[model samples]
Target: MYKARAWLSRSFTALSSNPLRVCVVGSGPAGFYTAEKTLKAHQEAQVDIIDRLPTPFGLVRSGVAPDHPETKIVINQFSRVVQHERCSFFGNVTLGSSVSLSELRQLYHVVVLAYGAESDRALGIPGEDLIGVHSAREFVWWYNGHPDGKNLSPDLKSTDTAVILGQGNVALDVARILLRPTEELATTDIASYAWTALEGSSIRKVYLVGRRGPVQAACTAKELREILGIKNLYVHIREDDLIKSPTDEEEMKNSRIQRRVYELLSKAAASASSQPMLGQRELHFVFFRKPDSFLESNERSGHVSGVHFEKTALKGGGPGKQYAVGTGEFEDLDCGMVLKSIGYKSVPVNGLPFDNHKGIVPNIRGRVLKNISGDSSQVENGLYVCGWLKRGPTGIIATNLYCAEETVASISEDLEQGVLASSSGLPKPGREGLLQLLDNRNVRPVPFSAWEKIDSEEKRLGSLRNKPKEKLTTYEDLLKVAT
Candidate 1:
């Protein structure tokens, strides 16, 4: 294998050339996937993947549910992608700050913005501005040890009941984390600090809330079912909680895993209502609670204490059917902590046009918008976007493969047309347009070779501990350790 990789590297270097420089911002699944596609599709092309986290594997390192170690195995595959002869990595990078899209366009013939979303959707409710309110995004980062989330520590020490808003996979993730035993978390890459805090949780009940009915919920069937399978926890479901819906063939036929999930949920639910004697923990699958306001204890606490929800009724199609958020009734649930898993959001990088509301680069298809012509401007030529950054944040891992391919096809088309940033090749005698743009913006993107050393050191350390490589969470740590 070593000999084979060495041979491939030599061949790749021999084939690589100018005019095929590609830079990808963000080292998440999407970013690395895009770089891998570009390098493999065009062996002569040079690919550089960058990220603000001194580490790579964006969400895998910072946001994937820590209990899902198998899911994180995807990182090993990405490691090989980053090892491409034509590829490199630059951690501790801020696109708008350290490297601007404008400057990247100057150096690389094609600059693909594959950075995934950077923020979370705001649950605009009354007490949301208070001391107890938080987003699952922040919670995930804190537990995962993202540098930006290093200081985030929620007081789960005394919590008896917790509320998580939104029913997506992320909402389910937080619920599981709050309920899992410490022994289960031992093998995962969960930060030591997070483990200690979580180990001490007094949490007895967690309500995973959703605005829409169960059938209409955004969470995938797999994610929802897995959470219900926890052995000791009671899963409560009110008959009224699950809006009636006609069953699909898949749901009726009961695939093997789906059958197991149903059995477990039934068992948990029966145990919850029958015994009501849950000694240490409880989990509920709740629906039809549209959060109208967040209850707070302090002004600057920025933490949520509880949630005020508006009563919503199905339009007779069942809970999963389209339902309306109305003023027919209202209810307040009591809890000391609340997490808004409403959804993930994108952040506007510096220079490239952005839609503050959508958290996506303003684009048509995969193209960046030069300007908003009217309803929406056409995507700009040469500048392409893919994955979460291209589309507003959503979709699982496989979803990005097709997404990245779409962008790659666009890049290939642009290259054939000679419509890229003109004269972005080697530095010329007098005037360098792209370099001048980088100078004007003060953006400095990293190269691919640098990423190799960072990858090596991280894995070397990871092997020692039996966890995925322990990430260099701080920017300085990455710069100091990475070649």
Candidate 2:
């Protein structure tokens, strides 16, 4: 008991004498939230956030729909978090290239991997690699001016009809962008190149295809409502498809949000025939259809002309618990473009234990586990994860707050337990060591102050154009602005 007490005293003394050094390997919502929680709980801890891009706010800046500018208000909060005295931002510094995970483990006492999903799930179907097929992830990033997406020029000129395979908010977002008037998006921070391409878009019809029924839709009620409210866009729905089964009815009764969504969908379907307008684009909800393959166009070789689908039906479970089973029946929809919006997936970082099935780093609570089962005894000390990388790619932006808090709590508990004690005789050098290494590598990291300059420049350009901030889509331009 005396030795135990003495060890505890020494641990606290060590932590108190020198502040804990924490390195967060992402500048997204999860990273910022973790930093905020860590800074608030451990006043002596210094946190450093690093990102692959010069600008921060991962998805908020690159993944969100351009027209939904209000959703990005969280950036203001993230900015303040980065500006904290105990926190530092290091942008344009990639984890694998600029420094290895092993190097980070050596430099900081604790390393938090908050880097969100970097890849999209693929639709394992024939002709998916065709010219006209694109992942909704790439499309969203292209419109939002992500440096990696700047070169992706989707062929909007060839298609009057587009089929998006998924019913999530992301699918709705893609549909809304395709159907929304260009004038509405002009005022937003959409990439100028995207705006130019969209102005010439021939798309007039969009089919939001999903494998599951309406009750199992992944989109939120707010997004559904917004999609329904778009002017000059006629929402087409099959009345039979909206009819709920006895099981679905019971599920809807239990969920207020589901009940409301059903009611709204019913109302829209009922009014579809009565309210008719000319020269209007059509948004069709095609449910219970699983993409079987993409059909090639005879006129344009290697380009997708349409999609083949196997009809699906709900089995056993109810509402969100339901799963889609393919029926013998088959159907085809002729469309020039296909955007697969199934979901996002996290890519495996070098030297990390990633579960390919779950698309996440194998972890118990917040501590990264050694294997896929996440055995408690195999916990990787001083290593943690939060957000989509910890959990799968699920939930909204606000969801990261709770997830990050939980991770921070786990980290705090570990600290108190002395699980983060240095194994080597030498103490970790933390940010100072990292900066010196970065300097040695000739890697010019964009600091928060430099980012502020870029922000100011964007706003200045926006003011001149009478629109939201104009983004630097290319790395060269962004680097120049930052400098």
Candidate 3:
């Protein structure tokens, strides 16, 4: 035990003498988890997490539904990480605009791109650019008070029926938010602007359209059940859509979650009454409907009035592998609002090799590769990726924890092998140098302390309204609060 303690003491001394400087782009779960793991493993490692927003906790603050405050509890854990002695946070610093990848590479010994997928996948059909057609990403952000999403004035006032394309958890979230009582959301951290707008919403029915069958839905059973539990919200499912294929029995035998989801869906459909409750809302699950194009409104030339869908049939495949084949038959459903919740895709950052098709940085495990071929021999030394930027957008928040561990392990291995030894002589300026560069550019970064002030102010304001917290939606307001 004495010898072991002595070795640890020696290790600490060595680490103190030569610390590893890491700059993680994107102050999200992946970035914080990576920093936490890296700092714990390397005693003398210093980390700076950067984000484009004035506030931290990227998706946790903006992507998660305000109604689900329990999920945002992860922010408390992230708060602890940013407050670590070896860690710092630099918010309101745009990656490509304020500081380029080349600049970050020159400033830190190791640069990890944990920036999440910010762009949503397009439906690539006609009339997608019409008014009243929104992406689930921007809609969620707008409701959650993301700076970029503040201007997204979705026309909820013009529509009594809304249609959301895609059957993922995000679609379910949109459905729930539309159908949930405005009074219930009053105590949550939902953006005041969104709350005010939603309070005046005329929406009464929401259609969740999926190209595939019920067994092949991307949403988890928990989210589906939550949508089903909303008071005065009646769920509708076509009986024919629930009919199983020949392979469904075999597939259901292999996965318990799938079985449970099927069971819940079936039970909900069986219990649904033909007539909705008085002043109640309706949620319709329309399966095997592939969106072909959006229909234009007669009253408003540029606004969407309905969606044209091509009927689809299930083809032979395994449980999760089922494919949708389009039939010639077409159907139209009238609605003023259409939100596409297909999925999210990462955008290409300057100086980073992005796989255009895959919508992710080209990398082998965590090491950023120079080409799309993924040849490890052609790796860009000292550059790495994690989270949705490394892998395509998928998985839950906990998924990033393991993803960060793997990336940090790779970084540690490279450091031990002296792959980054050449960085010792480089003009790696660390935080001071980076801050100086930002100063020169007149970029005011919101430090962790300032963010704490904003957080406190938000909570204080929320208390006045009996809500969890009120977010500052505008950039100017956030900066004002932080300053």
Of 1 and 2, the candidate ahead on lDDT is 2
Model 3, span 106-163: residue lDDT tens: 8888899998999989888999999999999999999998989999999888889999
Write candidate 1's Cα lDDT for 75-111 as tens digits.
8788888776667776666777665677667666667
Runs in model 3 with CA error above 4 Å? Answer: 1-15, 422-427
The count of residue-pair clashes in candidate 1 stands at 14
Q: Which residue pairs overlap in candidate 2's backbone?
A: none
Each prediction's TM-score against the native? 0.83, 0.95, 0.96
lDDT of each candidate versus the true structure: 0.70, 0.88, 0.88
lDDT computed for candidate 3: 0.88
Better of 1 and 2 by TM-score: 2
In TM-score terms, candidate 2 sits at: 0.95
Tell me the alpha-carbon RMSD of every candidate.
6.0, 3.9, 3.4
At residue 196, give the lDDT of candidate 1: 84
lDDT of 3 at 360: 89
lDDT of 2 by residue, 1-483 (tens): 343223223323234557888999999999999998888777678899999999999999998888888999999999999999989999999999999999999999899999999898887789999998999999999999999998889999988999999988999999998888999989989988999999999998999998977876778788999999998779888877987888888888788877877777788888886544778889999889999999999999999999999999898755457788999899899999999998899988888999999899998768999888867999989999999999999999999988887788777768777788542323789999999999999999999999999999888898787777999888898899898
